[model samples]
Target: MTTSTAACAFERKDWLDDYAALKTALEQRYANLAWFASPQGGVDLPALDKRTRRLLETAEDESMAKAALSAFVSGFHDGHFSTAGAVLQPKIAQPLALPKVDYSRLNATQACAALGYGPARGAAFSLPFESLPGTVLEADGLTRAFRSGVVAAPDGTRFGVVRIARFRQQDASPAACEQAWSERQAKGAMSEADVKPVKQAANAAWLRTLAAQLQHFREQKVAAVVVDVGNNPGGNDTGDWAVRLFTAHDVHSARMMMSAAPLAALYFDEQLDGLRQAQKEQDPTPEAQAMLEQSIAAFEARKAGIAARGCDLSWAWSEQRPWQPNGCSRLIDAGYASGQSSYLPPKAFGNLKIASSIYWAAEVDDLRGAWNGPVYVLTDGGTGSSAEMFSALMQDAAGARIVGRTSAGDGCGFMADAPPVVLPHSRLRYRVPNCVRLRADGNDEVAGVKPDLPVLPTEGENDRERAWRLLDTVAADLRARGAKP
Candidate 1:
């Protein structure tokens, strides 16, 4: 009556082992674990173990194990915490058949009328659109699911409309970049030459796209521009170009902090090495050398302080606390005063304050004479990550009006590159964020960016139609106010 282990449908022992490994990895590596643990009812290690045991006991296969893991991760309610490597076969609902629109023979004005808009006295152009459920049309040698262009009111006021589907770079595709990364890894460690080209091309293309839009606005003498980012899942930080076009100086975007000293040290070392290599290739200017020297000195001081504390190399300063000389006093006082918990590091490690650094958008030289007109950005719950970051910058730095629903709160904090790990047993890949972004104002966290003019769709009105209506309304309002370009 004895059963062989290999013949069993599910192995409880194997599942338990994998679960233990995953728990350890999460505790040690997950950036948000400490912050979220207490809020989620104090971790409850033994209770978690018991729950996981029951889950494994009932899990019929690897798929069930993965489901259990996914459920466990979802309890954190963190958008960044996710499980990959699951072959999902979701049920597909039948799509509704809709009539397509034809605009091949129509001129710009006629096309605008056909697309449910009034006469277009100004130029109309095609916009690259995707994901939106609508009829697409070919215009000006471009495939456009939506039309975006300049419109001039009868009163001689002009407005520019630009619809952006995502924050992805213009020239580089995600699939191509991923493939290139894989190829580079197989060849060996990536060099500057291997990585720089794709990044440079993407940057150039993104800047070019923004520049083109700005040039068009200037040419049309538009008093304002509407940027549509509705239903954007977000992508790269290429939205910086738009920020630069409106901002005259450097703008402090966000603050970044690492959970571990090793991570920060690794980043600093990489930056230093890159700068030094550049210096070696050609003599750096006096100012550049001085900057490098200062950075080196700062890095050394931090390293010495860490060594003196006797703390593990992995220990990093908490971003929650200010980096004063006696910053650790409050932590120590709270722990000793309560006697319920201790914030102190191991005896081998001493107390040290870690400093949080600010990220800024540097002024762009090419954007010196760029558009300074009023800006309106459209957002929705689907706007997240870099899209949220862009919206924050547009609102905080460029004085752009956000006109739509509140954005997705994915960029509440910052995340650094913590690559995914594959489980040995079920081969499930877990992606963990490395660093937590802390802002002094705490505005970008959780609540997301608020819209200046929150627009909601009415009955029988779709999101697209509502957005267009809002854009026109805002333009008219600006026109009424005698806003000038």
Candidate 2:
């Protein structure tokens, strides 16, 4: 079909039909749809639909149609629920240009303060600083220096600090690096291989910088180490490296929920079976054999109950499992035990079976780490996704005090991996989250993580200055208790 014809073909009737189909599919297959649709709180689907229909009717062009769809999906209030395509990519904002700051004007004392150090004896701040006189201290300069560095407190006592702005995997393998290079080349973003480093340096720098700072803190016997993720926008979940600097005990952070109970049950079955087989091959001890048997029996019983409810497990065998769990968790309590009903009925004979074989629970763990120190995490409304995950871990696991405002609450709990749905006419794409993240308390929305010691920036104070003030406040309190080194 011609472009103009295709665009004209997407009439009100066509859009209405498509909307109905998409809504039905989400209700039937999307795991966290019910949670987002719950009466307690969730997107008002009817209202959203009304708004969407109105936008569609008045839309003057293809771009308008796409914008309407984008607005409609954003109503779900999930960061992970987003679109991606050639058309959508341009709409995404790129990183801001760093502002140039004249650090030459500031004297040594002002420079130290700018770097987050106080003038009092034994007073330390966790700001990123290189050499005192030579450092540029501009926006980008500070960012690079703060990625990892060490500086002296007023009393000549050295302190360490590492700024992790995101949680992406640093030091990707050679193959992955090459693939990224190729993609960049294809986009005409980069031309020469030599122009890029031999390896991907973004995440590697973050990891190495953090490790170096931690090592400096350990060697210098700094009073305490500060991990700054105040402006973090969140990324991967592999940020446990920072936590391991202080402790090694497993810390339970958050629980995860699958799209459906049948999918979770099938996963449990596979895990249990793998354990049973491994034990059999190892010629298990009596205790091991007994444990394996008990686990298998339990799994079998659960499967039998699901079967009795007329649920089908055949769908689990598909190569592309529509609903894949993103993170891991230990089963704390079953859905039935908590008197929680299944989000949806199980599949039976290619239809939804009217039974409660679906299992769910409240308690689950997300980011596990061993950090047992006097940790203080700085957060702001921008903290989201894996960044929020890190904040939750610091509070729930290490008992770290969170200072600053509440987090952005991006709902990494319900992460979505589904491919965007492209509109044939407008070429607009829409996406939805597939998984649901729940805290131990059974809540997963964008309400954000609250700070223990709430501190907001003053009239002219930036986040860094506010953070420095809070650190000084914390240090003062600790000193009063004779806790300073």
User: Which candidate number has the best lDDT?
Assistant: 1
Best by TM-score: 1
Supply the TM-score for candidate 1: 0.61
Reference-based lDDT, each prediction: 0.50, 0.48
Model 1: residue 472 alpha-carbon error in angstroms: 5.0
For each of the candidates, give the backbone clash count.
Answer: 4, 10
**Residue lDDT tens for model 2, 1-485:** 99888777657655655555555545434544554444433456557777888998887665676677778777876666566556454454686888643444443333334333321221112232334322222223132323444444333434455565566432222223334344444554332342334233433444444445555556656565556666576766444334444444544435554444354465456545554554544344564455446556665665455323332322221212222233111112222221123122112112111111221111111111222345567677777777777777667655666777788767654332445655544455556454445554566534467888787768997645555566565565446546443
Worst 10 residues of 2 by lDDT: 359-368
lDDT of 1 at 390: 71
Q: Which stretches of candidate 1 lie over 4 Å from their true place?
A: 1-8, 12-20, 34-64, 75-77, 86-148, 151-158, 170-202, 261-264, 278-286, 299-363, 412-418, 443-447, 457-459, 472-484
Error of 2 at 29 (Å): 3.9
TM-score, per-candidate, Cα-based: 0.61, 0.58
- lDDT string for model 1 (1-485, tens) is 24455347566677777777777666555545444433222234344556666887788776677677777766655566677556334446885777554433333333333333322211122122222233232222123222356654344455666655555543223323334345445655544344455444435444555556666777878788777676665666455435666544444444443334344455445444543443443444574455445545654554345323222211221122223211221111000100111111211111111100101122133553367778778787877766676777778767778887887756533233555656667666777655443333532233466788877768998654664566566767786767777
